[model samples]
Target: MSFLRQRKTTSQIPLYTGLQIQTSSSAVPIQIVYGANKIAPNVIWTGGFSYTTEKTKAGKGGGSISGYDYRCGFALGLCEGPINAVGGVWSGQSITYLWNLGLGLFYGSMPQTPWGYLTASFPGQDLAYGGLAYVATASFDLGSSPSLPSLSFDVHGLLVGTGLINSWDANPALVIQDLLTNPQYGVGFPAASIDSTTLLGGSGGSSYQAYCTAAHLALSPVLANQEAASSILSRWLQLTNTAAVWSGGKLKFITYGDAPLTQSGVSFIPNVTPIYDLADDDFVISDDADPVEVVRSDPFTAKNWVTLETLDRNNWYDATPVQVWDQNAIELYGLHMDSSITAHEICEPSIGRISAQLLLQRSLYVRNTYQFKLGFEYCLLEPMDLVAISDVGLGMNKFPVRIVSIEEDGSGILSLTAEDFTGGAATAAAYPVQAGSNTALDHGVSPSPVNQVIIFEPPPDLTNGVAEVWIAISGGLAPIYKLADGTTGES
Candidate 1:
C-alpha cells in the first residue's frame, strides 16, 4: 500500500483487447510525428474476414465440441514515412507476443508488398500508400469477436534524409524544418522559407547543436489531431524560450536567450550596438506627455518555490514532479507555489528543475513592463531583439529591454511593448537538493560472488555414510546438480 509501489487503475488492467492506442477515426488526422509515440492506425484495408471452428473433446476423445474464431487481414495507416521501424507493439496493456497472428507482419512504406488477402481478392491491383508509414498483417485472430482489439505501438517515426536520419529527431530546430517542408499534411514550405540567420538554423552558428549544446533542449513531440499547428509550434517556442517571426519577408527563429542544461554561462549573450538604441529623440511624444508607460509588478506577484511538471523517460514517460525553491525570493517575498510550467516534452529531471528555477528567478526578478512608440526607422525591428531605452525626462539611463511585441498603424506609428531583461538575472541558479525516490523500494538484494569452492574426500569418522567426495562451496546456494556434465541425473 506504499506510494513507492506502482499504482494500477481498472483501465490499466490487462484485457483481451489490451491497452488502447491513440484513438483512430474514420477520418483521422495523420500525425507528423518525431521519436516514439503510442498510436493506433486507421484501418485502411480489411479483407479475408472468415470464421474458423474446430471440434475438441478430450485430447483423443474425438467428440464434437465447437470453438469459434474470427480472423482477417488488414493494412493500418500510421503516419508520414519512411520511418525507422515499428516496435513495442502491444495488445490489451501487454506487449504483443505470439498472438494468433499470421507470421511476418510487414512494417514499411511505399511500393509496399500487398497483402495476399488483397492480391487474392483484387487481382493485379496494388495501391501502396507511398510516403505514408503503415503496417500490414496477413491474418489476425479476434477470438469470437469480429472487430480488432485495442492495438497500440511505440512507433519510432524518424525522418530519413541528409544522412542524419534517426539522429536528429531529438532536435526540435532541425525537426521543425522537416515538419514545415513535408508536402503531405504539412505546410510544404521550401527550405528558402527560413532565413540563413534564423536561430533554428543556429542564429549563432550553422547548427542549433553548436548554439545550445544540451540534451534537454532537444524536443520529442508528436504533432497530431489534438492541437493546431500554431499551438503546437508555440509549445516548442515556450519550452526553449525562443521565438519565431517573419521579418525581411522570411521566417526567422529568434533565440534571444536559453537556459541550457549542460552549459554554464549567461542565459544569453547578444552582440551590443546594432541592438537598436532608442533615445528620447526617437520616442513619439504622446498627449503632450512622456512617451513611455511603465508598470511595475508588486512583490505579491512573485513566488519563492516553483514546481515543474514533465514526463520522466525512466518511469515510462509518466508525469513526474521537479520542485525548485528560490532562496532570494523567499527572503524578499515568502514561501512556495507552482503550476506555471507543464513541459511534457522535457524528459530529464535535472532539466525540469533548472527550468523551474529559471521561472522562479524570472517571476521574482522581472518586475517591469514598458510600452512606447517609435517611428518607421525601426520598422525592420522584430520581436525577441534586445533594445536599449533612454529617457532623460524620466531620469533613467540607458536601460536594456527585450522586445515582446511590435505593431504599426496607418499613421506608421510603430507601437512596441518591451520587458526588462537583464543578462545578470539569467545566471544559473542552485536550488536546494531535490527529494529522491523513497528508500523503501530499494529492497531487492543480489547474492554476492562465490568466495571459494573445495572438494575433498572425508575421513570415515567424519562421515556417517560412504561418500566418493565431499564438495564444499561458499557465497550462494543452488539446487544440487552435476554441472560438469550439464545434467541433473544426480539430484
Candidate 2:
C-alpha cells in the first residue's frame, strides 16, 4: 500500500463590507441604501435569544414555565455630508422625511412619530443579513475637534416578530398553513416565506399539529404581529419538541438531530485541520477559569403539573394540565424549587417536556469558559452557533462549544465568548461537598446517639490511608473525623 500524507486545508476568512438599509413601512419598494464610504467600517451588531424555565415549589401544583427573550441592536457611523437638492445625504424628499424622524425633528410644535421598520444587510457576507428592527432609539453623537466630523447612530429595538405593538383578530383555531400563508397573520416575508417543505425535519409535523390545535391563537388586542408570532412559535415548539432558527431573512424549523452547518475554518476540531489561522498576531485566546454557577431546579414531578389556560371561541376559559419530569435529573440534583410562575395559552404534553429540557440544558452550563478574539476571520459567526475549539497545547482539543456573545471592536476585530456545553453535568457531579467541612469546636452536640455514619472516599491521587467520616444524629450536631487516627472534629 502506498502511504500518502494528509493535507490540511487553509482557513479562509470572508471579506465583508457595505450595509444595506431598507424601510418596510412604505407601500412602494424602497431602494436599499448601501453603507459605503458614508458608513463606518467598524459596524457593531448584537442579537440575543434564550429560553429558560423557572422552577416552582413542589406542592404549588405548578409546572415549569418557559420564557424566551430576543433582542437585536446595531451601532454605526454615518458621515454628515453636504446636502444636495437631488442626490446628497439629505437630498430626496423621502430621505429627508426619514432623516427628520431619525433626528427626532418636531413637526410644528409637536414631535413627529419616530417609529419605523429598519432592516440592515451586508452584501459581501452570506450571514450578514439582519432582521427588521423597530427604531426605538436613534441617538447621534457629534465628536470633539480632534475627532472626525461624523455622526454615530445607535439603533436598538426588538426583532420584527417580537414586538406586541400591533393588534388584529383571527380565527381561534388557525392551521399552520393558513397562519403562515394568509399574508395577514403569519410570516410576511416576500422572498423568504416558510412552508411545509421547510418543516420536514424533526418534530415539524408535531409543531404543525400543535399550531393547528392551538386555541385562540389570534393576536391579543394590543399584540404586534411579530409578538404574536413569537408567542405562537414558543408554544408550537413547546408542544412539538422542535427548534426553529430565523436567519438570512428566512425561518427554518429544525430538529435536534439535524446536521449542524459546518463552516470551514470557523469551527475548532481537534486532531483535524485548523479552521482558523491561529498564528496570526491579532489572534488571541483567553480562558475564563471562574466556576460556573450550578443551576438546579426541581423537576416537574407527577405531583406537580402544568396548567395551560386558553380562551375558547366563545371566550370561555379552557385549561389543560400535564406533568413533565425527568427522573434522572431529579435524582441527581435534589428537589430545588423554581418559584417563578408564568401562564401559557397552549396546553400540551410537549410543554412539560420542553420545560424539563430547559432545566436539563441549564444544568449543563456549569463548565469552564473560553473567549476568542480573531482578526476579522469569524465575523459571520452568530449567537447560538456551535463551534469547535482545539488548542492542544492548552489541553483543549476539538472542544465543542456554543457562542454566547459576539462583539466587534472599533478596529474590526471580532471577540467571542463561549462555554463548554458538554462538561457542565460532569463538573457539577464532581463538585466537592461542603457539608461538615468547617470546624466549630464551640458548638455542643445534643444528648442523642449518633446512629448514622457517612463516609467520603479520598481522591485517587491522595495515597494517604485516610478517608473523611461524619457521624450524625437526628437532632444532634454532626461531627467529622479523619479515619487515619480517629481524630474528631466538629462540623
Candidate 3:
C-alpha cells in the first residue's frame, strides 16, 4: 500500500469517565480500551493516572501509576508537535518510538523515587498504579482516523501517554512485553526492540536523546533538590531570581559622619549607630576654642545696653574734664538731696566741696558722639529762704548799690558780688544799710536791685554760667528769676 496522508492523532477523543467495559475472559488483565472494531481508539483522560512500567513474562505485570492523580506523582510534558495517526492498533512501538514522535509519560515519585524503569509488552501486563485509569486507541474508517471510545477504569497501576493511554496496553498486569508484542503471539516483536535506531530512529540511537528533544520545555522546573540547583545556577540565568546587587555583589552598607573626630587632622567621625540608637551620641565637638554665632533682633535698651562708672570732680577745673563718649556710662555718686533747698544763715552752705573720682574703661572716651542729660531738682524747703536787696537799699538801706556783677569761667564755678545802698541805718547783727527800719521799703529800694551775691560751682557742661534760678519768700512761694530790662525780675 502506498503511504497516504494521515491526519494528526485523535483530537476529538473524550476524557475517560472511569466507566468499565466488560471484556472476554481470554483477555489477560482486561482490555481497558477494547471495542467491536478489535482495536480501541485513542483518547485522553485528564486528571487520571497510568502506570509507566509493566512486568515481565515470568511475573505478573505490576507497577505504580505515575501522574498527579497517581499513587506515585509523575509529571508529563507533552511536546508541541503533531501526534501520530497510528492508534487503536496498539502499534507495539517501543517507549522510544512513542517518545520520538512527541508522545510518552514522565514517571517519578511524589516525595521521591530512588529507582524506576519503563516497561511494555504485547499482552498480560499487570496494573500497579492506584487510581482511575484511561486507554486511547484509534480506528481508521473510510480513510479517516477516529479515536475509539476510551476505557474508563479505577484500575490501580495502569499505563498512559501524555494525552492518552493505548488500548491494547490497558491490561491490569500488562508488562512492557505485552505492549509491543502481537496479542496472538506471546513472543518478542519488532515494535518491542530496544535498538536505538529502530526505537528512537536516531543516528545516535539513544533513548535519552530522543526523549529529551521531544519533551516539551517546562516554564518552571520543579526541582528534586532546590538548594543544590540554587547554589549552582547563575543569578543571571535564573529567571525566577530577581534580586539586584551593587558592584561588590554584597548587601548594602552605609556609614555616616555625624560629629567631629578626636584625631587632630580629622574633621568628622563616622556614626556607626543609627539615628534611633542612643549610643550614637559619643562624638565630641571639633575644637575647644570655637566661637559661637549670635543674632540679635533688636539693639540693647537702657535696661542692658550700657554700664556706668563712678563720677569725677577732680577734673572740675579742666576743659575736657569728663571725657565720656556716651553719657550712659558716666554715673554720679552723691548724697541724694531731698527735693528741697533753704538758706541757712543766709549763706551757711556746706563747709567744703564734696568730691569723688570717676574711673571708666577707656572705650568710653575713644568712641565719641554721644549725649546725655544731668538732672537735679531743687525747691525751697523753708520760708524766708530767699532774700533780695537792691541798689536802693538792703532792708532799711542807706548805701546806694551802684554796680552788680557775676562771673563763671566754665570752671564749674560762679562768682557773684553786688554793690548795695550806702544811705541806710545799720541793723544789729545784720547789714548796716537802712532807709527804713528793719523792713523791705519799696520807696527806699531801687526797682532793679541785687540783694544776694551767691557763688557756687555749676553742674557739668555749663555755658556762660547762665542757669535757671529761683527764689522763695516767707510764704514758701518760689518764683523763677531772669535778667530782663536791666533787672533780675520774676518771669
Top candidate on lDDT is 1
RMSD in angstroms between candidate 3 and the native structure over all alpha carbons: 58.5
lDDT of 3 by residue, 1-491 (tens): 44796756633323333322223222233222211112222222222223222223443555332222112112222111111222222232211133333333322223222212222321222233322122221111111112122221111122222111122111111222232353432233444233222122221222221211121100111111223322322221111111111212222111111122221121222222211111112111134521111122221211111222211112111111111122343233222211211111000011000000111221122121111111121111111011122121112222212112333345433232322212111100111211211232469753553445555556545636667454432322235676756666553
Q: TM-score winner between 2 and 3, please give it.
A: 2
Sliding window of 10 residues with minimal summed lDDT for model 3? 347-356
Best-matching candidate per TM-score: 1
Ranking by lDDT: 1, 2, 3
Runs of candidate 2 with Cα error greater than 4 angstroms are: 1-181, 191-228, 231-318, 326-333, 339-347, 350-355, 358-370, 392-394, 423-491
Model 2 poorest 10 in a row by lDDT: 30-39
What TM value does model 1 have?
A: 0.69
lDDT of 2 at 105: 17
lDDT tens digits, residue span 1-491, model 1 = 78899877533212222312244466667766576555666776666667756555656656553555667766777777767766566677555532334424444566566555566776665565666777766667777666677766556675421112123235667667767776655676777867656544322342343333332355556666756667777777666545688877788776544333333221223343337778888999788767788988878667777777776644445578887776776777677575667777555565566556656667667778899999988888888777888887776677888888999999999999988887646434544434344223445865555757898999877887677688998775444666666866422
What's the ranking of the predictions by TM-score, best on top?
1, 2, 3
